[model samples]
Target: MPTQVIQAQPSTNAFSGFIQFWKDVKAVAQPYWYPNDSGDRAFSDVIRSWGMLFLLVLLIIALVSANLFNSFITRYLLDIIIEEKNPSKFSDTLVLFGLALVLVTLLSGFSKLLRKKIALDWYQWLNNKILSKYLNSRAYYKINFQSNIDNPDQRLSQEIEPIASNALSLSANLLEKILEMAGFLIILWSISQSVALILVTYTVIGNLIAVFLTQELNKINREELEAKADYTYCLTHLRTHAESVAFFRGEKQESNIIDRRFSNLIKNAKRKIDWEKNNEIFNRGYQAVIQIFPYIVFGPLQIKGEIDFGEISQASICCYFFANALGDLINEFGNSGRFSSYVERLSEFSDALKSVTKQPENVSTIKTVEENHLAFESVTLQTPNYEQVIVENLSLSVQPGEGLLIVGPSGRGKSSLLRAIAGLWNAGTGRLVRPPLEEVLFLPQRPYIILGTLREQLLYPNTNRQITDAELKDFLQQVNLQNLLSRVDGFDTEVPWENILSVGEQQRLAFARLLVTRPSFTILDEATSALDLKNEGSLYQQLQETKTTFISVGHRESLFDYHQWVLELSQDSSWQLVTVQDYRNKNTSITKTTGNTQLKIDSFLKDKFQTKLENSIGEGLSHKEMNALTSYSLSTIRSKASKGESITTNDGFIYRYNKDPKVLKWVMD
Candidate 1:
């Protein structure tokens, strides 16, 4: 999960760098400020935002002016105390100084408060904007394959707020410090232009150093952000696959994986620390040397009686404020590396969202058409990357109220075909005709457990369906999960259904959903694989009872009883669709792995399909005899009986049997 570091180009041109910086800034900020294309953000909102910002600007100006005024007042108060030494005069000037301090404090606090308020508002709008694109056009899913943009969840959840908040902080700090620097420079100018010019030269040199150092900080900040994302994602991956790890007893392997990521994070943290240390040393040294500028220029003047001692004191205060203001500006510039890092990241994320969400123009992809029935017309499905063809030049259709089962050898695109039908994969040339997605329900092997009440679990994909308590209980009973209600508080109770229920139980619960919503067309992807034949048959019976047109992907021959037709996909990309009976007979020929010859499975089962005519008895059939008679191998019979399914023998020696110790059972067709 560790993201690859993108090195900053050290020789990047100044003009080109400014151009890129402006593009990143505009991409991130313009949508919030401009009403056009921001459908959700209104013009009135824009006006109000600009108005608040204007007030904030005024507040900053007022705050800086108050600081300058107080500096002069402190000088006057000192002159009175030192020269006049009269308590009455000093008391009046001291009161004036105290009032000035109060003004400065109020202005400073209000400005900061306003700045935060504006920043928060911008964050709200930008989060929603990015979130919309992330969810739109399945970008949330598609963005994962894009390796360049890592940890979108981290970006959306953590990085987004910083863009708005830091942009405001950077601007406000830059504005306030610049104002202070300018005001102090004017104060110093009145005293001596030569001294003011010297200080200006120092400020210019300091800015040049900050610019160079900030570039290095930019690289460090970027790596730190990426490393943190990688570390956080590793922890999340462990949580998700905790069960798999426990099953394999892979704690050591998992620990090593996490440790590797942690080491990278720690390494990046160390580099950042080193950079901060060097930057801090430079900052302190720069400030230490600037402290004596006033003494160098005006200390001799005060001794010569050219100016009052008070003027000397005022000059030193002005120099301190001036240097401190310039230092704050330089510090902010250095910190802009972090700001620019965030800006570039957020801008790239936004652009990537836009790119992935956009529907490709004039691209060759499968076109989906909504209709009352399901069909594929000359549909050739390819993997999303177009790297390999799943099935080529294929055509098939499922009639209304009919069931179609897709079967194939392992890795023959059986599941991929279903994905194409569901509109999840549509990379190849095709026209897929199916019912509207809302009317279709897809149940995969692993049922998705939404975070909500038990009722929501059953009523998923359509939670608003009003099913009475009695009706819900009936649905549960139909799936043989009536006992589920006893274990829970009620149908409305919320629990982590996944961990609370076993795989078989989860599958049955998914069938319970089929009963609740009863979608017009259901597509199941080995939905009942975890369940035994008895449970699987029970669910499929309910599925047939619902009379919904369904397509199922599974390897079990028991699925033959539920579906009307079988669409077998061969490894060579050839396909054949026929009745379930014909498919059962035909499949024995399709696979040569077992043997050269195939038993006519239907010919053997058709004559002995009956199980209710009489109860099975005796040592029904020997393993070899049964394989010869019913074309059902001993392994198949053992597999069937292990799951406790009813057995029918072809010899008419036994009809149906369960727990009959003498009989070797095989499930009936």
Candidate 2:
């Protein structure tokens, strides 16, 4: 068969892309202008509560008045110097000029101070608002785990400050320039209409060219930001996985990865610099032309005596200020591009937070009740992707003070079922009835070692509760962690607990927390995987002593002694539930054979005792199987044969079992 090639559609032209970019910019800015509940209150609150509008009006008035007064003084000084012809009049002119200069300076300084204060206030308010939403809504988790939004940490930590500061500064400066332009345009037009016309035409054309030249600047900035974030993420990843990398001696590999990320960052940064450089060239030329163009236009009139030296000088000053103010868009084009990029990122982050925080409408949630029971009714469990059904139509319940053990092969959704019961996973149609969130606690295999003092670690997830040192000490003793107090310099000492404590020690500490809190219900997902049998038995005994109910997902046969019931999950979303004793009886039944044949019952026994064999597989055989297979005593053989398979021939009966030779020999001895 001939191969067929498919081509991608061509990209949009610059004009269409530019239009789309502006549309996106407007969409990002719309929330700031017309905010909803999810939007930050800082912008609206600052404008309303801080008298920002009033301040802005005052600032504009002060700036325009100051510039007008300065222009008047310039004209007055020139006129007096040229026509005075008297030393006494010159001294008076000098004194008047000094007073006007001081007044203009004061007004300008006061206006600048007000602008700075407003900007600072907005910065602080917006930062607090963004942080409040980011944390209070739990957007951090959604962004990190559930959403495709990148670098929320950077967006929240780094981008927010600049957004607040630059947005305010740019808006204030732009407003002031507009006011200044209005004041100067009047002065320039009065001096010479031709100069004013030329100034307006030049500024308009220059800004138009700048807009087209820097149209792609925002896209470049966004790419640069992403590259920088990627590089930072790589460095952070290396630090987080430092132990794994060290064990594998992957320093060179990690360095190569870092170098690749840095290279990408540098490439994007170079593009940004080059774009800005080209932009700066255009702005600088436009600025230089604004300076000299007025003189060139009016120099002929000055030489012809139609306009005096003072008139030319005054026109030049007014024309320069007016043209510069009009050219604000051209001069600050790069900053505007950067600001737009910041706004786009922050706006997207805000939108993501809003979407994540908003409760899904018309979606069923695992309804939690105030009762002391956990129940699942016709629950169908599936992965988050909904690609595979893990458990189907499963119904079970555990009352207060009763324990349930969930057992299944690996990847059989054992842990996912626990998550659903805990209200973390809700991808399928199911009704889960559990105690209120506050009354339940979940302890996974690897206990979470929070960064804090030992006392704080015990009191975590419940930090506000006040407990005496004696009570904390007693709880530590209950979990066999009393030595932790002295080893870590008492409860108040702060250390990196995850690094300082062994995994077994951490698991014990987590159990200590359980004892201290005494939650109404607890869910343990292999929570005892790090502890030995003795320690595990002690912890379970402690739980049995309490009125707290728990459901455990484990593969330890010893755990069977603690749980009253077993919930076995099988393939094809099938499951079975039976009392612990009944399950043991079914698996321990013996099969008798009458013919002269070798019976193979390992496959059947393996399925029944797989959970126990996983941890107790001594040299590829279970401890019980080793003893039964190697025993020489007829009594032991009969007892072991009762729980396994046997064959009887015409001459005699033969017994055989699978186990390790060493353990079998030891049992025989």
Structural similarity to truth (TM-score) of each candidate: 0.84, 0.75
lDDT of 1 by residue, 1-669 (tens): 112234345336888877788888988888878655857578899999999999999998899989988878877888888788989989998898989988988998899899999999999989998899889877787666433687788789988888888888888888998899889889889988998898789867986887788888878777888898898998998898888989999999989988999999999989989989998998788776667777777778877867776776677778778877776777777777667777888887877777655555655788899999999999988876667788888888888889999998999898898778777678889799988888989899998889999899989978898889999999999999999988889988998777789888988999999888888899999998999777887788889888899999998777877889999888888888899878756654454225655434465453453332232242343344455545355555555555555444445443332455644443233
Least accurate 10 contiguous residues by lDDT in model 1: 610-619
Estimate candidate 2's alpha-carbon lDDT, on a 0 to 1 scale.
0.73
Number of the predicted model whose lDDT against the real structure is largest: 1
lDDT of candidates 1 onward, in order:
0.79, 0.73
lDDT score, candidate 2, position 431: 79
41-78: candidate 2 lDDT, tens digit per residue: 55656357457657766766876787777787777777
Off by over 4 Å in 2: 1-50, 82-155, 158-163, 212-223, 263-284, 298-306, 331-367, 381-388, 426-431, 449-452, 477-505, 532-534, 585-669
